[model samples]
Target chain A: MVHAESSTFAEGLTKEEVYTQVLEQASALLEGERNWVCNLSNASSLLYHALLSLPRPSSGVNWCGFYVVDTINPSQLILGPFQGHVACQQIPLGKGVCGTAAKEGKTQVVEDVEKFPGHIACDSRSKSEIVVPILQAGKVVAIIDIDCAELAGFDEVDQKHLEGFARIIAEGSDF
Target chain B: MVHAESSTFAEGLTKEEVYTQVLEQASALLEGERNWVCNLSNASSLLYHALLSLPRPSSGVNWCGFYVVDTINPSQLILGPFQGHVACQQIPLGKGVCGTAAKEGKTQVVEDVEKFPGHIACDSRSKSEIVVPILQAGKVVAIIDIDCAELAGFDEVDQKHLEGFARIIAEGSDF
Candidate 1:
């Protein structure tokens, strides 16, 4: 009967501190849960609420979720668990930001999504986005995708911490 | 690029009308998507935001999500996509409201969760709940679980509409 604790951040916590707390919370939440569906579902909720608890640019987060490699179609990434409005159902590898992250097996942090060629507009309000590849054995199994309503909403700090967050997910779940 | 449409309801729309619109929207959102992960992920978002657009008791919804029959462990239900606080990762058959719905292959609408025998409280804020079993070929495959903050939050209307909602999900996806 593990219930989801409401997200509440202490005042004056820096962005790094918040992410650190979020990653710790995610680890605790996913403990003893090896099912990727269950782990990713709760992780997305935790991350989305954590971002909402932050201040300014970070608080502008509009979407936070996952896109996992489709088992039926290996070349595409199907929408996984997410906490946001509805979203794109499928993204071909090497196409959108999420796909590129999976294809290149690296992180993609776009300060302005409009400047990225072939950028997919899943939500019109999203001006910036960050996609982190969740790699296992040097191959991407999924990606952590976040969108912000303001330009330059994500930076190196996000890339670093989110990559750590992705590692936690990869290790904690049997993907 | 199919972006999630922000949920909006016309002023004075009846609950049935809202449910009708939600079902239609869900059908449209799930079109051509047979993957259960993609379907359930978006379905939960659509349902959660749709309930938020309603007034009063309906608007008090605190949790709206799903739990599918575990692929590895057939006797338990692993949490599926959802839009709410984190929830129980797994529930044994016939152990909770969701389990009862799946075990009996029927709907369970508890007016007060405290009174339900062996109720599993995944969110303390949930005062009432409704669990609708998603059946495919007379076997339960998944469930539609919704929780509200007030007692008797769900009634016949919710059961009817949510059952319709569940059917839409079952037919649209390859669970």
Candidate 2:
């Protein structure tokens, strides 16, 4: 019988502790399932709910999802599995935060989206954002995009953990 | 500039009216975007949020998502874009509510999931479900699955509207 597993973080855990749990859980979830779609879909849910389980700042996350490199148009990134509001369907490389991350093949952590030049406002309420490029064999395959309603919602802790998360996705999935 | 569009239903709309709006909005969101992943991602968010915007029974929705026929394993359905907790990664054709719809290429509206044999409980809180197969070229390509927390959450109206929603997805996406 198939069972529904809870993705919530345990009570009283620090943000780093919660993220540690998340990375472990994500690895376990992706163990034998190398399908990129499945892994990414579940990973987003796991990350979204884990963030929501925390108090402010982290809990201020309004959007958590992905944008994958378009197969037909290599210079663009298409929307992928997400746990948030409807978003832009396509973003070209080097255009916005997501596009910049994909084009530069590096993580873009914007303390204030308004301060970032060419930041694409996919969600008007998103004051801060983080985009982690998932690279495989030195090529950008996809990106993990997180939007927060609070300013400076993401810091180095998030950068380090999310980069680790991206590595897990890169090594776990077939993409 | 990429702008985030709201998918919320207008206030005080009846259930049928809300569904009508959902169908129209889904079409507009899907216009010119034939990618199945992007379309399904947005469609699931649209439907899930639309349902949540309504009053109880409708607002009791616990999950809404899609499962496409596996490209590698023809008889299995792989998890697709969704708006809910994490779900089962795979369901063999003819095994559960989602699988049955995929295998039969028909809609399955179960008033009480517990009463249905071979029901796979991806979410234990799901008391009811409606699964509509998206058929293309006379074969099943994907399924739109919705789960509700209330018993008998789905009726003929839901079946009809969701079938229409399935048709829109079938015709709009490349699969």
Candidate 3:
């Protein structure tokens, strides 16, 4: 019974609960969808809407999107599907938080972007960020990046859940 | 001086003035960028941020994006880069507003989507819409879609400006 509808996670749910639902909904939404662009597009929407449905006092997410490794220029990561304000179009492979994540093959949970050296402030409103590298065949192919407007917005729970989300995409997608 | 920054127009600026700046920024952003995906990505970002910078009480815009004619399935339009909430992925040509725009090779300015027969309610919050076709060699290649939350949200001004916007993309992009 799954359709193109954006699924809504229950309100006042814990971060882990929200992400669990997100993973399930994402799996359903991404079923039989092999187009990398199309999958990333829906994945961003899933995360953005699920997080926005959280209860009051929750740190609102300002951005959710992907930075995909450029096929033409293998050393750079170009902006992929995203939801939020305008963003930097490209990031060198080893520079910013996204770049570092890709380079080190690790998840970066930035508590405060201002303190993160070489952080590319694509939107000045983004106070905190979390990036999970999507690895395909031991190579960083893409990264799911999320930003919140409040300081210390992302925690280990978010990191853990988002990494799971990334694994699903990495394993499911052709890219 | 034209970096990847989103440009801002003045408050109370005329629609023509707003679109004039949009075209200018669009041209600046599209220069030497021939990739259709990259161009459409930045174009959507340009229009979204440009309209969002308008003054208070202005009819707020909810979604802005593109539905590109699928090369594999020539009779359908697939969702491209976009901002705002999640959106419908595919539209059979001539079925909905975006499809009709692609089928007719003209612009569709729907004052009230409720009255527009066959209007797909991808997002229920969208009250009005405008879709402009991007034509190449007299063939419909894609359509730029904008949605607003207010009834009668779009008008002749939007149709005129966005059509012009479409032309620039048609001529400027390699699609």
Candidate 4:
């Protein structure tokens, strides 16, 4: 199913079509564990893995990672699996993309990293990024962080779709 | 804002409006208490607090509770909270409105009690109900279980509003 060449972005697919596709695929994906309907952490790790398995994940994504702030120690975001340069695993909840996303419970899309308050350069090659918060009950629990080597790599499509995916997994979790 | 009068059906309030109100006021409710997030063991206690804070939360609700399958313990919904009588604390994940909502990750609006499968009659006076799951990442973390005292007590307004509130709180997280 590696179909980056056949991706809707390249093919210019309709929003309704995309919405239908996602809706149609929702249950199957949920049952398949892509949405991880039974668990939160494992499902997120699975989501990152699925993204990595996608075609051209690396070109657009300089890094793909998730971060969980230490439950016992609140000052750091322990790194989840990632594909990128050495990252600063420990950052305050108000610093950098991961931190801000966690702090605001809103997605942070940076088309220009240089303008961000405190952009952490995990990879100097990275030029833009998007960080979506994993919200639980209204507080920032974690974040699905993606960095792209290209500027303006993400758009409303990615925002709505990825957030939809996050909703599929996080909206009903126990942990 | 306790507007719903008894001896008659409450009508005209849209679920979307209730949901928007809940979302807009979420930060105000959950921002200060060091957060009320909970787990299976303390689930009831958390639900008790939520029931108190939710807008006019008592109008249609006779018993509002929280139930979680003791993941480590297995097969029983550990008791959490309620504004009324003692409840059947342990319920299977696939059984009642609570279980079904948790299992299906969809809101369950039961207008008739006799037709409800595995309907736990904690309150014989309650003839109708609505249940919404609190999801996180994509898993059923917890459920917002409400039991109403009248037949056909919950309408689409209740269902959609409850669902939206469940999603927002579960995602944005206050506890």
Best by TM-score: 2
lDDT of 2 by residue, B20-56 (tens): 9989888898887899998898888889988998888
* Tens digits of lDDT, candidate 1, A1-175: 5676744456677888888898888888778889999999988888887888778798899888999999788999999999888899999999978889999999999999999989999888999999999988878999999999999999999899999999999999987
Error of 2 at B123 (Å): 1.5
TM-score-superior candidate, 1 or 4: 1
> What lDDT would candidate 3 get against the real structure?
0.80
Off by over 4 Å in 2: A1-3, B1-3
- Give the per-residue Cα lDDT of candidate 2 at B30: 87
Interface RMSD of 4: 23.2
**lDDT winner, 1 or 2:** 2
The whole-model lDDT of each prediction reads 0.89, 0.89, 0.80, 0.54
Candidate 3 displacement at residue B109 in angstroms? 1.3
Q: In model 1 chain A, where is the ten-residue run with the lowest total lDDT?
A: A1-10
- Score candidate 3 by TM-score against the native: 0.89
Q: Which prediction has the highest DockQ against the true structure? A: 1
Once fitted onto the true fold, the runs of candidate 4 whose alpha carbons sit more than 4 angstroms away are A1-59, A83-86, B1-175
Candidate 4 CAPRI category:
incorrect
RMSD of 4: 20.4
**lDDT, candidate 3, B1-175, per-residue tens:** 2233565456778767878899988887777656676677778878887787775223488888888888878998877888767677678999989999999998888888999989888888888889999999999999999998888777787788888899999998887
> For residues A48-136, what per-residue lDDT tens digits would candidate 2 score against the true structure?
98888888898999889999999998989999999888889999999889999999999999999999988788888999999999999
Q: Score residue B122 of candidate 1 by CA lDDT.
A: 79
> Cα miss at A52, model 3 (Å)?
2.9
**Candidate 1 vs candidate 4: which has greater lDDT?**
1
Give the TM-score of chain A in candidate 4: 0.70
